[model samples]
Target chain A: MPKYLLIMRGTDESNAAMMAGIDEMIATTRQFIDEMVKAGVLLAAEGLDDPRQGVVVDFSAETPVVTDGPYGETKELFGGFFMLDVASKQEAVEWAKRVPVARGAKIEIRRVPGSDEVPQA
Target chain B: MGTVDVEAVWRIESARIVAALTRFTGDFCLAEDAAQEAVAEALVSWPVTAPVNPGGWLMATARRRAIDAIRRSVALRDRYPLLTADTPPASEPDPDRIDDDLLALMFISCHPVLSPESRVALTLRVVGGLSSEEIARALLVSVPTVQARITRGKKTIAAARIPFELPVADERRERVGGVLTVLYVIFTEGSTATSGDRLVRPGVAYEAIRLARTLAALLPDEPEVHGLLALCELTAARFPARTGPDGSPVLLEDQDRRLWDVSAVRRGLAALARASTRGLGPYGLQAMIAATHAAASSVETTDWERIVVLYEALGRVAPSPVVDLNRAVAVAMATGPERALAIVDELTVSGRLAGSHLVPTVRGELLARLGRRPEARAELELAARLCTNRRERSVLLQKAAGLG
Candidate 1:
């Protein structure tokens, strides 16, 4: 079965706005998680720490460059995610649509194929 | 061999190679023996100097070993397709058309001549490509016991002269159930243990699912094949919630449905749809029952009427005391306790499930629901005494205490 990582991203302004109303957002999100749990689709749900506390390593240069977060030129902060083992991308999209987030936040759903998907020699 | 993952490659390719060997050599025992010998030799050498092509290396080595063994066997009795020590057998069989060989291996492993234990062990070893140690640990049996069963199973096939070919049409339809039954038993062992502290044997359960998927691919037209797959997948979807954090059994009503695997539910539903095309078989009916619970928001909201109907259908297809008992439970939930009690009372009178705690336990629950406190408490107490599993006994004891 394939697993999907529902990545909810927002700009710093959006993040701050959501945090300002964090209690209600948290309540709605918990309700959303409860729905997923009842449907038996939720594998895990976790929130990311402040992006300022995160680090970024750049390998594009010959020597690796390690930069502390609030990474430069970063458009959106990739926040918390809900990992679900669901049937299709469409199903994942439906679940993602129900995520409670700030107005400016965007969610990206990525599928993780099984290790068996790698072709053998 | 520089850090080659020999075990992983063997896990994926072992069945195909062994199946092909059996087809070419026309000797099931020799083919399996040779394949193991090849893997054993690779395990010794691969870590130090890995093969450029691991699967190919194993295949060539196994064929060589089979030829050598045939030479020695020729001194006693003639075995066809005998080759000289240095020669490769006439020509390589095409691997593309190897599904028949796999199906044949499955049938032979689950041959009626062998005992149930042997069938499970043999299927895990050959078809599932599991190590004896892995099988033993998953099954809670000793490695020697697993090895003995595999060895005895192969001997039985030889003695019974089970042909290395798929059973003919009529026989194939009849015997596929025997093969599916072996996989089902293995899956049941992993998903639900009757006794012991371990509530779930994930390794065995996952292996059974992998094998079932393989069978479904091999016999795409067989509805029961998909039925077993659906049944296993749907039942396994609840595994995450089946046990609590402390590894204690969680009853169905108390389980957190949010913990179910959504992808597994989808997989099961798809398989169930395929199963229904030919009408619900025994496993399909069970899968339907599982799906009802999977889709339900809670016990109160569960479609008990539909479950009762499904169980009734299951009773007709695979009539057993357990099925009848399950139907009665559904009946109790759907309508009332009186009718369910009548069914349990009939079972009690028949003595078909004499030593099993299940009958008394169900009867106790129904009795409690009917407000027969004294009798319900007594039945639960008797059930607690009869139950061999510690966890189950604890639940029964709790029920009896609740009645009191």
Candidate 2:
């Protein structure tokens, strides 16, 4: 079976500086998506809402509290996501190499959890 | 009737037929010489028969002639298993087999071993089937220049002992990029001539476009090839509107969109769709950027912000000063002229584009937009002086005059 999702985050500071311009960021992302699709590796890809629009829900307590914008102290945040079907971790890694990320943005690769074991919102 | 005329016609058809004959005979020089001899025969016989299948006839005669030559030469007596064993296979080979030959020939003609000038000359000679004089006229260069480039290009290929066969898949990807780049460069030069008396060289541009389209068809699965074809089609669409009645350069903003070639645009869009299927690489990304402009009805309606983004992506994939300059232009249109000017200022200060007319021309535009007429006028004048293209220089002068 092919690995479905390879989660990635911007890992380098230089890459972060490169993304200073939003127009350039979007253009690069779209191009990456276009290439992935043509290669038959891309199922779907999307850039997330701005960090300010992101809402993190905490379910650790009885009552879940939601916080917005720069929600946590984690240096690496999910800026965008892509769902791909590739042969192995190596193939997924190869695709990751082509992503247009900021110089220092971290790309964390993780397998998508099955529905039964999905992380709760 | 003249020797050069015969040589010219032979050059046009030689590469393709030679490639096909090579596959048949499995001898490179023999295939080449036999093809040359067949052309000589055609020079005498064509005037009389003028056969419908000249290429086919040449292939047939060349195969037979190659066998005859090999038989007469003592040096090749031991290696005559394939040629002497059989009555040469029918000259009219399957089209599928010939496609491979043509593809290999195209790759060879546009090989990276040759310089850009040499690549273009060889491509025109071998693929576009153009004579040296024709290429000379089309490029506005001396015939001797074209002749010398082709001579050196062929000699280099021979010296390198480059196999005249289609590369394997892995190697194809790497090598194909060079071929595509050469064609793209040719099309760009013809479309917006770097330094020339005329604004456009339709013949050269058309030939490049034709070759690109052929390559795209030959390799349908290669996204970059389709992307290149899309870029050519989209860019060529504007040729009709890129100049005025007196052949003066028409700024993109002032061009009449209605005059654009709609069919070419449509074809470009279709090719872009194919390109998109494979995911955009540098050429595909650039084509997508061009498609953004082609999609808009007018300059104001163009998605400059998207273009800026595409250029940035292109920069990452293919880092070049030219891409950065273009991205800056897009930034100016998307954000503010001031921001664009700042970027241009940095680029200039860094000496990345020190002598390029683009730096001053872009700076002048931004300055003009910011209401700095005097500064803008001076920059435009500087740009005009730096520019060697008559059409572009005239446009810069007009902008300067308007500023005053």
Candidate 3:
């Protein structure tokens, strides 16, 4: 079995729509999580807090520049992710397709490679 | 004898204590209540001064509780004396032999009078020594639901006057089968959702294994008993590789075989050997089928011929559509898709599996293998539509799409 991290993200328009109907969205999302839990597939799931409450540190210069509050651009900003152990990338795609996201929002799935997959010295 | 020690004692001896209490009091509910009270007392007192004979201590204390409860009941005054026996702690029956009283307790808990749910709850409660809360969590039901099932089951037993004694000679085998079915149901419930609506509860399956081990020990002469134990062990051995963290099922052929539990496999095979000693019963046949898979490196390497024969025998004894459908799968693997297609077509004509997704799923696969792409796709689409499980439905749709 392989592990997949399903990252949830949305464009500005989609984010605004989610904010407008947060309760219904949350309810559906929770129901989705519950289904996974019942199926015994859910490993971890957590929604990120507002990106505005986050900070960015640019380390390009000798001294890092730290800034707080919202990013200059919210173009499909990362939201939250669910980590799951699934059979294959296809199964992960099915799960991603089932996510209760707004029309413009999309789930990006990345496979977490096994430690054993790496060549040992 | 701290709480840990008390817990250990209770875990190991609670069932026997409850059984003896039931035998003494002739009441299931009362026996359970008294046993719980005794455990509470042990929790309080065992930490200070541990008893030399822990099981006897618990049994004696529980027996006392049952007696006290009866003494307090005015209407039960006349029957009180019969409940109180003069057996000393040193005189407790030999612990090595299988206690008929404990076997009777299992029969009562899994009695045909109770619904399957009630039987599961009662079996875990009295035979496995699980608390109502634990049973609730393990079965994924509310505590109230487990309690209600247990209460209703006990009341029905009392009202029906279901005896505390074991069944007579002729019906004993059937009765034992009932008990095995309860444990099998529990294992399947814990194993996965494929069998029915139940979600996975790892604890429940392990508990069933424990109970089956207990039952196997108690019925050493009965090959089917060992057979069931083997079936549970072997099936559970695959649990490690069966599903993903998010509960997505890993198809057996695609599962990482290296992840399978070896020790469980060893134990299962041993039990299967014992089961074969008396000729394969229904459970033994199933165990043999599981054992075949267990010994295989891959589906390609599996002994499909032996499996087909085993399924044929199983169909004779268990005669279910599911068994026949499974046999068709083996037939395909052992021979070719054409023979397997014939089996599926016969089943479809019979309409024995009208609404199930399984028949069409296999039918579509067979058709696809035979290069009938359009019909295969249609069958797969129908399977997807009929399927209620989101995960399986997704797989079916994916398979259908692949045909394009």
Candidate 4:
């Protein structure tokens, strides 16, 4: 079973929509999670704290330049992620299609590389 | 040799053999299945032709089984080419790797990737050398459920690439907590079933004790491990008298003191002494509480004040609504029902334990002691309605009816 990380990114509009019906959003998300759990594909899922509580540390400068919260020019902010055990990237995307996020939000599916895949010395 | 002797030998050696195989193959499920195959072979051949070195024979047999399995499965061969690179060994597994292998096996069995239930089932199956049926009986789950959990647990560990080795010192501290929690949950389930017809399942409880002993041996300097062992020993010492002839629950106050296991009490005291070398952890504190209960000849003579103090410390260290409810019970014993009732009411107002039957049950007892009959009856009835365990529910109902 290859584990896939489903990263949820939210736009400003999506964030506003999420805040409007937070309870219903949470209920819908819980139902989708329950479905995945029953199917035995869901490994872990957790929502990130609000974007305002986050920080970005850019190391492109000689010394790292630390910026607080979301960047002023930010369009899509990574909001949360779910780790699922599935066969392929397509299967991972199939599961991601069920996420109950607002319309403007986007999900990026990526496989989590296992420790065994690392080149040994 | 008798079946008991064979089982005893297998239990003692299974973890070491499987651990070594897993390290060699880097496949947990294959190692466990090979170990099982070797044990099955032992059952057939051991009685007919007893080997001089039984443990070594089992190891070699299991190694061969692993090779045979890899050869049989194309998927496994492609995935674990390293395992099939060499021919099966004729000699025993390397003795030098036994200790580290055992420790790594413990870590792997209790890896954080698996759910708590999965960890318990896998640990008992691999480390404790229990069959799926035995685990199902111990946990009161269906055999299929246990099998599914074990399979999924192994798949999850392999999928997550959880390494088969002891973690670094800093990481070990956090990881060991998860291991200890699994052991504690197993002991608790065995001591007092969460929801079952029986109050105590000796087999499960005894298995937890055995696993704890192995863990304590492997990690001798860890105080919390010894603390957990001491707690299990002290609590299990009272198991002999925890039920009546008809198998009904015998409350601590009502139990016959003569039936207590004196040897277990002595062992618990020794382990507690070792745990006290450092400051008491949560398990150490709980062991102290159990030791206090064991020391008293009767419930009236039990040091309720000390228990109350212990619960206070426990509340600070491991704060939970259950702890508060327990502290209220201790207050009732140490002081008066009036003081206890006040504490219970405060807990109710906080709403931390709103839906649990324990809150109402304790409230009912305190109210009954304070001569508030109607309120006590209602509370006890509510507890009865909420309880799921048939025996416990019947007792609550009896108490409610008696209040009227």
Candidate 5:
């Protein structure tokens, strides 16, 4: 019953001041992903293409209206995320606390709804 | 052939068998003595028989030795009635019960009555199963120092009559931090020797890391356990790159990206993720900061801003001058040297890092950056004088010379 989605702001700002080459960053990111897979905590995790590719969907209208990507302020934008199944909320929090992010960058922890249902992309 | 090789392997495997025996015998001193006797027998026999199940054989033989010793000792007759009245439990044959013994021995070794140094030595001896000589070599201290620590440690535990069983949940949480602290000190000593020829002692660090991993496995539900594991893993990942070819200290900025342990970093990140399932404690926050560096390919690319933020959080949870000094560095990297220098100067005036060489070294760097060569040289010379490590002193002196 313990499922969690760890959401945080992306690396767009942090990566802006790249004194180190991007190739190294990409490689490190890949290595981090490989580690998550090996540990078996990663149900699904991915870096967004950019906030530009994202969109907001509203169901309040008769038909679903899709807003353009990068809809929110940069500080509030959804960045990267991960989903995991652990033994407890405490376990989930432990995992979230380790994510590489700016100190005050908010990490939103939400229990996945209808976890038994087929996972969506 | 040599006792050192045999002792080294025994040190690695000893805690498990000793812990198991303590549970069966319910006598800490007796169980430990029996284990040592069995090891002595192995030294003589293994060069001949070389059994495959050495640990198992040791546990079985140690139990028998404990039984025999109990029968011979009239002094223990009243105190250890259980041992004198009956044959050793047939249940000792089961290897699975070793877990309980190990848990009990861990608690006893880390009992609250002992000082942190004694706790570390005791845990390494009883729980890690290291001989005094091996531990002495590892710590780079004299054999007598190690012997004194273990003897004093055991006497303290016995005098206090600390229980031979792991505490319940609340008590476990209270003591677990102390236990973890010992392991951390051991690992840190290995990673960066307080005073030694080598920059890193892989053996000590690896032993401590292995112990932390074992504890993490034994207590899978404990968030702090994972936090410790994460911290060790992430720190260990930098081991290969922390030194130059000549064994000189490699500043974090100068370390080669390829030398870092990707696997250890990954393991650390995973552990950090697990730790996050609980509220961010000091260790977890520190691990998170390490993760920022782990995720970066080079120092410049590291998420210094995020690291600074984590340090601020860490300061709240574990307020130490050392943590503050580190945070100052991160703040400087994220913001500017001017800001970081301000903080360091404040710390200096407050006498937070009065005797520490690090504060002066950092101040020198900031002064150098600000184009104050004469002042920077003076600070570097002061740092060199205060620093204990020969290598660090050399670096500070070299920097001072360069400034001049």
Candidate 6:
């Protein structure tokens, strides 16, 4: 089976809205996770720390340059991701569509190549 | 079965058996050891009493051995209820799920969590059915090192709780790239020794080719897999003419093209066609460059301009200092030495390739073309000193001497 990653992105307004109802959000996400787990498709799921707490290590120069805090542009922030071992990209999309998210949130689905997909001797 | 037949069967089926056992036992290291024990038993008994289905027999034996090990282990006592010594009547693993097991083995062996060297060693051991000593000789590492890498690789996968199953579709693409990179690393080291007396280890290169052909056969739909296979095949075709009979390095321009392997070149071109149909990836682009060289009657007639364009595209997708240096060499052929030298000088100032001999070697050739004999000789001498291969060092020294 191939793997797909569901990248959940949220705008500042949507993130604030979700955080405001944190208890309800956690319950809703847990219920969703439980569904996937019961289906035996979910491999891993993780949510990110606040964007402001992150750092970027730029390697454009001779020495790596480390910068602190949120990225320069903050139109959309990566909120979390789910890795699912599904049969195909379509199936992954179906799973992503069921994710609980507020308005202005987006889930981008990407196919992960499996060992069977890799060429070998 | 004859000894040779037994060896061949073991080589082909070892990975499948180990993978199946791993899935059953939920322990990678134990599964591998059980599989090894089965192969050892096969070597001892197969010649004496050949089985109708060697793969099935091996799988049954391995599965039985796994149960025995689990049953004996104090740590595994809690899982004894889950274990079974019932070797199925059929020798084969469940037909429907065997392919998945093999695929899982590939991913586990080439897991990105392990170091690249560890990946190569472990993959060769578990996937390719090679012994530690064979792997040691192939990669020019000691036997203990090969063993250690394999051991650590298995432990790492187990400790990290890496699943013994194929990844989801989204991660499979990245996983494929990771596996290809491991194969490429092995092939590259085989083709050009990074720090060895000899310029090449033909055995390792051939081993890599074998592994690549297996990959291509199994995953015919993956374009980059074919791309990597094409690259390795075409590059290896030139091996026969790459060195002199006395073991001195033969520069490409001076090597006898007639000695190149025609059959390998044909296979490479066929693989390249497959890659092109799906749109060329980075390895495909590199294979195209090799194809250009292979198709040319001589170095002067090779399409340097096309090579430069491919390199530019390659840079956009997979930018690296080595690619830039290679592009500069192609540029020298397409344009002039002065233009190429400027590019090389820029790379020099960037200091990305400060320790590599390739920079000085290319600079020396460009300087020679520009009639700067003194500077060319000096650069060639420096390259000679930096070179690790005795054969290549001699060739570099010869170039420096000819400048006088």
Best TM-score among the predictions, by candidate number: 1
TM-scores, in order shown? Answer: 0.76, 0.71, 0.71, 0.73, 0.73, 0.73
- Weakest 10 consecutive residues, lDDT, candidate 5 chain B? B1-10
TM-score of chain B of each: 0.95, 0.90, 0.89, 0.93, 0.93, 0.93
CA deviation > 4 Å runs, candidate 2 = A1-121, B1-15, B25-37, B64-81, B84-92
Model 2 residue B20 CA deviation (Å) reads 0.7
Write model 5 residue lDDT over B1-404, tens digit each, in one string: 22223454454457766776676666777877888898888888877776655545676788779878877878665546665455544444443455556667777887879987788888778766677876888888888998888778877877777778878877778878877888899889888888877777766886677677767756677788789889988888888788776788888899886777776788898888899996878888988888898889888889899999899999999998888889889988899889999888889989988988999999999899889999999999999999877777888999999986
Report model 4's interface C-alpha RMSD after superposition on the true interface residues: 21.9
- Clash pairs (backbone) in predicted model 1: A37-B258, A38-B258, A40-B260, B1-B48, B1-B49, B1-B50
True contacts kept of each: 0.00, 0.00, 0.00, 0.00, 0.00, 0.00
Considering the true interface contacts (CA pairs under 8 Å between chains A and B), give the fraction that model 5 also has: 0.00
Tens digits of per-residue lDDT for model 6, A32-113: 7854543335657999999989998989899999999877677678889999755346557656767889888999887765
For residues B81-153, what per-residue lDDT tens digits would candidate 4 score against the true structure?
6665554432344434665787788888899889998999999988887778889999999999999999999
User: Model 6, stretches more than 4 Å misplaced?
Assistant: A1-121, B1-6, B43-54, B74-96
Per-residue lDDT value at B160 in model 2 = 84
- Write down the C-alpha DockQ for each prediction: 0.03, 0.01, 0.01, 0.01, 0.01, 0.01
CAPRI class assigned to model 4:
incorrect
Residue runs of model 5 more than 4 Å from their true location after superposition? A1-121, B1-13, B78-97
lDDT of each: 0.82, 0.75, 0.81, 0.82, 0.75, 0.81
Docking class of 6: incorrect
Query: Of models 2 and 4, which has the larger lDDT?
Result: 4
Task: Give lDDT tens digits, candidate 1, residues B246-337.
Answer: 77778999988887877788889998999899898999999999999999989999999999999989999999999999999999999999
Please write out the lDDT profile of model 2 over residues B242-318, one tens digit for every residue: 88878898888898888777767887898899998957999889888988988899878999999999999999989
lDDT of 5: 0.75
Off by over 4 Å in 4: A1-121, B1-6, B44-52, B72-96
